[model samples]
Each structure stands twice: as C-alpha cells, then as structure tokens.
Target chain A: MKFSELKKAVAIIGIALFVVVLSGCSGGDQDQEPGEGDQAVEEGLESAAGGETCASCHTDKKKLVADLDADPPQEVEKSEESEGEG
Target chain B: MEAEDKVLVAKEFLNTVHGQQGCTSCHGGVEPAASRKEAHQGMVAEPSAQKDSKCATCHADAAGTFEMTLHKTSRGIVDLDTGVLAARINPEKADLLQKAVDNHCASCHIDQCGDCHVSRPQWSGGGLIQGHVFQETPNPILNCTACHGSRVQKEMLGQGPSDFEPKLKPSVHWVPAGMQCVECHTKEWIHGPSTEAAVRYEVKEAPRCEDCHVDDTFYDNAYHKQHAEADPGKTLLQCQVCHSQPYNNCYGCHVGKDDKGLAYFKTDKSEFDFKIGRNPLKSQDRPYDYVVVRHVPVARDTFAFYGEDLLSNFDASPTWKYATPHNIVKVAPQAESCGSCHGNEAIFLLEENVAEDEREANREVIVPKPPPKF
Candidate 1:
C-alpha cells in the first residue's frame, strides 16, 4: 500500500478507538449515578420507595408509628452554615 | 445535657410518614456527593429552620400550629414590659432594652421545631438525646431546662453553688414522681398559637397549682378546707402562698456595652427569700390580696450601654414584682403555723424589708403593717 494511504488508515483507527472509549466511560458513570447515595444511613432509602431499611432495627411498627404520630423525631444534622458561628 | 452524649435516633421513626422522606430531603447538602465533607457542605445544623420546606409538606397542620407557638416567636420577654423596668423606661430607652435583649436574650428563644422535638436546644450546646433516633418526648434535662436553668431547672433540681451554706430544696413534684415538664406543660401549651403576651402570667393557660391539686372532697385536707372557705370581702389566696418555699431573688441587674461595644450583663447579688406582697396585678384572674414576690435584677441603667435615661419612670412599677417561684414543697416552713403567714411581719413585704431607695417603686407590692390575724 502507498505511504499516505497507510497513514490515513491508522488515523481513522485511532479516531474510532477514541470514540468507543469515551462512550464506554460515560455509559458506566450514567449507570451508577442513581444506584447509590453518598451516606450509608441513606443507602437504598429512596424518597419514592421510602426508608424501608430503617425498619430493620425499628421492628415495632405500632410503637414506631405511635411515636411518630405523637412526637415525630425532628432530626438535626450538622450544617456548614453554622460551621464557624456557634 | 452533656456535650459528649450521642443521641440515638429511633429506627421506628423512619417507618412512619416522616421516615418516607429522604434524609437529604429534610437535611440538605448530602445528596449527589461522595465524601462526608461534601455531604455536609452548606448543611443546616438544625433542619427545623427549614420547616416550611421540610416539614410542612407532609405535616402541614402541625407545622402551621408550631409556627405560632410562643417558643417559635420567643415573645415571652416582650411582656417584660409590664414590669417596672419597661414601664418606667422612656420609649426610646425601652427600644434600646429591646435591642439589648434581641442581641443577648433573644437568641435563647425558639427558632425551629428541632430545637424541642429533634435535638437538645442549641443554646445548651446541641447534642443528641438518642443515637440519631426520633424521640416522641424530649429529654427534660437536655431539652426543657437547659435553657430554663436560671429559674425553673435550678430551683426544681435543688442545685446550688458550692459555697451555698444550705443546699436549696428541689420541687416536691419532681423527686418522687419523676414528672417531666411536658406532663404539666403539655404539647397544647408548647404548640399553642402565640398570644403576644409578654409574661407567663398573661398567658391564660399558664400552668396552675390548682390544675393538679383539684378541689375535690377526695383530695381535700385540713389545709384545703381552711383555705378553700372563701371570704366574701377578702381577696382569694394563691396556692403558692403556703406551698412555695423561698427561691432565688436577683436584684440590681445592669446591662452595659463594653468599650469594644459588646453587650454584657452584671447583677448586684442573688439571694433566696420569700416575701408576701400585695399583687401588683390585681385583675380578676389574679384576685389574691397577697402574692409571693421575688426581686428581679432589672435597673434603670440596665441598658446604659445603649442610651441614657433608659428607664426614667423606674418608680412607675414595683421593684419587687409578683412572681411564681418554681420551688414548691407540699409543706413549707410557714404552712405548718398560722402565724407564719398571718400577722407575720417578716413574711410580708413590709417597708423594712426592701432597700431604702426601692421603697417608692415597691410600694404597690408592700403589704400593710397591720397584718390580718388568723
């Protein structure tokens, strides 16, 4: 084959390989986005499905519901806003 | 009340409608992040601050009612105006007093729901009551009295300084019964709409001694029988007259701004004493001829840092005003003897009891010398 033709064929192969590699990386990331959350406490606890994992320890449904109905736990997590100022 | 205590969160709470919400839904800055630092970035220490965004969605009714609570508005101090300090101070000076309170005292007022329900009050250095569990009832020591330390908590717990000669007595109702503040001061009281009343006395449903000590024959005793017999012309007595013991009395409170313009408060002294005085507030609701009076440490110069002539009408109201000290005993020293209260010059707020300069402001609270014989 001619020298120019061989060079063009090699360039086309490199471009095709780059496109395939980019698609694979993007696809893998997109697949994992909704699968897991950052915190272990909220793992598998989806807003739509509700916090089913919480029931693992709090097995008493009646007592739990009563506690919530009468005095719902008002959870307060750490905040960046109040980071420096007490 | 300790800082190191790790409050456990109840797993059951997550099973309810509230649990259905994503942790980050109410508590932001956690979602779409990989690291702990990123999760807590821009997060709120108290999620209740976002009640409108977090709570109102699922629990609209309670969120609405909670907004109107006295805890939410923190208006109790506003009623301090009824006392001599606010009444006597010039309107402009009174404005400074408001400013002083807004900076120092007002922060203690309720800001969000989690302050009471979710976690220990932020004022006491916030900590968890349970291990991240949702609590139905608040920890009395941590949540309730941490902020009420000066009066209710200290008196009811019989806590005193190390130098105090005799240790103060705890409330009778507290020790054996183990009654929590929420028992008497119910959710209705906490969650009720703000009446904009300045003091607890103005709140119609202010917890009363009579609520538990019902006037039924089943519970009637010699003391009740004797006191319950109403006299047609005389002012009815309050239950605290005989039941309450001497409690902390603070005097000559002065608030000033330091050279750098930081606000600070100073008090002359604090003593434990009981004095019966004519009720400054003689409305139909409080028809007692004599009521317990405690000295508060508010002076004309309380807000001297803010401005001068702050409390020009200092004498317009009594220095020692009617009060309800939380230190209650079923049988106080005076309750056993008729003369302890009746014809007892020492117990009554006579002219001799108060400071010479304070007589003018305390005239209304001063009982007449000729005590009624029992």
Candidate 2:
C-alpha cells in the first residue's frame, strides 16, 4: 500500500472513533435525565410552601433560639397589617 | 414567632436513631447552598416518592409488600366497581362515566409509606405527626381514623350519635380494652400483597374470627365450631353475621362534580341496623351460607352528573354487599337464642323486606322462608 493511502485510512478511523464516542455520550445524557412525572412532582414540591425547607432552618438550634427570641415579634407585623387593611 | 416556628413549637419533637442519617438523606432535592431559595431547589415534599429507591434499601420487604397492599392499590376498588358499571354501558357513555370517576372517586387513594408512617395523609393536607418523627405503627386517630372516619371510625369508636337508634355502645374490643386497629389487623394483613382480593372479602389472609379465636378454643367453642366448621356444606355462617353489633347503613349515595371541578358526594339517609342476608360471594376462602351484608347506598344515578342512566343494570350487583362491620361485641342479640336469627324473619332480609329494585339482585341473599323449627 502507498504511504499516503495509509495516512488517509488512519484519519478515517480516527473520525469514526470520535463519532462513536460523541453518540455514546449523548445517549447517556438522555438516560440520566429525569422522567416527566418525577420531574413534575419534585418541581411541584420545590415551589410549594414559599420555597421553604423546614429542616434547613428549624433543625438549627442556634437559628431556632434566635427566631424564638426575635424582638417586636412576628405577630406584631401581622397585627399591624391587619389594622391597615381594616 | 413566625407561623412556621409556631408549627415547630407546637409539635412534640423527638429524634429517631434514623434521624442521624441527615434530613437530605430521606428528603432530597435541597441544594447544598445556604440560601433558603437555593437550599429548597427541586425539593421533594414527601420522601415516600423515593421509597422504592431510598427506604426500600433498608426496608425492602416492607416497601415491596406494601406496594401490593389494598391501601396502596385502593384505586383498584374504584376501578373494579366502575368497570362493572362500564361493561353495561356503551363505549362512549362508559368513557364519560370513567372520566367522572377518575376525577372524583380516585381522589381518595391511599399514599405511600411516608404519608402514613412519617406524615399525615395528603388527603388531609399533609403535615408532620409529632414533628417529623418516623412512627413504627400508625396511631389509629392520626392515620386510620383520618381516612376511615365516616364509617369504620364511627362504628369502631361509636362516634356518630345519629348512626345508632338508641345510642349504641362502642366495640367491646375498643372501649374498655383500648384495642387499636393494629392490634387485630397484623402487619401482613396491612402491608402484604393483596392481589387475591377483588373486594375486601376476597382478601386471602384477611383477619378472621378463627385467627385469634383458634379452632376448638374457648372463643371457638362448640357453638362457633358447630356453625362455622361442623356444617360441612349445609349451613355455614360468618362470625360477623351473628357476632357483630348493629352497624351504620347509608342509602342513596350520589356523586357529582361541582362547577369548580371538585368531586362532591351526598347520601339521602343513614341508619343503624343488623340484618342477616345470604352470602353474595362463596369462595373457598369464604364459604358461608349466610353473611352480614350492608347496603352501600349506591343508586343507579350515583354518578348522574357525568351521564344520564349510566347504571341501567344497577341491580346486576347487590346494593347490599358482604361487610365486616367494625362494631363487634362479646354478646350480641343474635347470640341470645337460635330464634333470634332463625325464627325472626325481620332480622333476615326477606324478599318482602327488600326494595322492589333491589329484590332481583338480593334474590339469593334474601331468605325464602323462616328457619323451620330450629
């Protein structure tokens, strides 16, 4: 075989390998994506209850102590708002 | 305190050994970031969604078996009941009825493990029971009664004054003894696969009187054995037929969709009565001549909102289906004497006692004549 022909053959094989690798990667990406139902349910919860993870804030003993002793109190704002509304 | 903080304060806080695994272990979807918005991203409100993945890792047997339980597949009841109705109707009309049922009846389906064990049911607007503690056995009040409130709860707890004629007593097993649902209903019965059961009666390992009573024991004395066992084939009766107290019965249940697309149901009447009718089902699991049948209050026009004359062959299935009433007493009126059931035609649902429309469906169940010199 000619030296030039062998060079062309090697280039062709390299391109073929690259295409196979690319296709395999894309297939994995599709497989890893969450299905429609699961995505919807999880997304629904994420949006619910004002985007709060109750444990994230409530479980922290320091944060809980700070929250309980909050001055002017959370109820005061609500009462004032109610008065304004009335 | 914030409203959220108040909820925390009000709850009875306790941590299980499992809690050491971190909140994100069970409740995933929180981002690792400290910001509340970022932390809550893609959060799963109920960890039950991941039961097969997370919980089943440790509780494979329970989670796998629970997947087949009646509670998990309660929607099957609605399907079976409606399928019977659909088979009689035209394809177009059946499809319409099914749509109404899917919207209304299927809404009350039971949830996954976390719904009962970790939190209150979604139907009751999900919340923590004793502040996010994992419970081994469900509290009857918080779990069972939450769903079974109207009928079983009323009967078991003797709640509704209207359901009784002269203020009936609560179940003896429940009243002084304080027996909860789980006491009699075992884990196998509750969580085990129930593929055999088309209705509750057909459940293979359903709690039977003989299960605890033990054949030939005191509770299963000569009298019980005579009726339930010795009969061979001539005369056999379910324990509930004779042992159960008068239970609540509802008539004329009507289901309809409101303008806002919510399912609403109403019953014309509810009354307490103890009546013996012939067994509607006669399977090897439940081979009985007589059984306690309760009128479920489903009329032909139960789903008239969806389509008119949907259940034309309403009499195909008996309005009165066999039931295991929650109300059971050590001594019942029927047990007083053989005549209480045999001689008394009133107690047995005779042809004359049944409504004209129901007579055809209850022909086999309705006693032809009073017991002859029993």
Against the true structure, whose lDDT is highest?
2
In candidate 1, the second chain superimposes onto the true chain B with a TM-score of 0.87
Candidate 2 reaches a DockQ of 0.02
Compose the digit string of candidate 2's lDDT tens values, residues B20-117: 45556766656444455565567676767554757787888888888877787664445645333433344547677677667656657566887778
lDDT (C-alpha, whole model) for all candidates: 0.67, 0.67
lDDT of 1 by residue, B284-317 (tens): 7777777888887776676676778767777887
Question: What TM-score, computed on C-alpha atoms, does each candidate reach?
Answer: 0.74, 0.75
What's chain A's TM-score in each predicted model? 0.41, 0.45
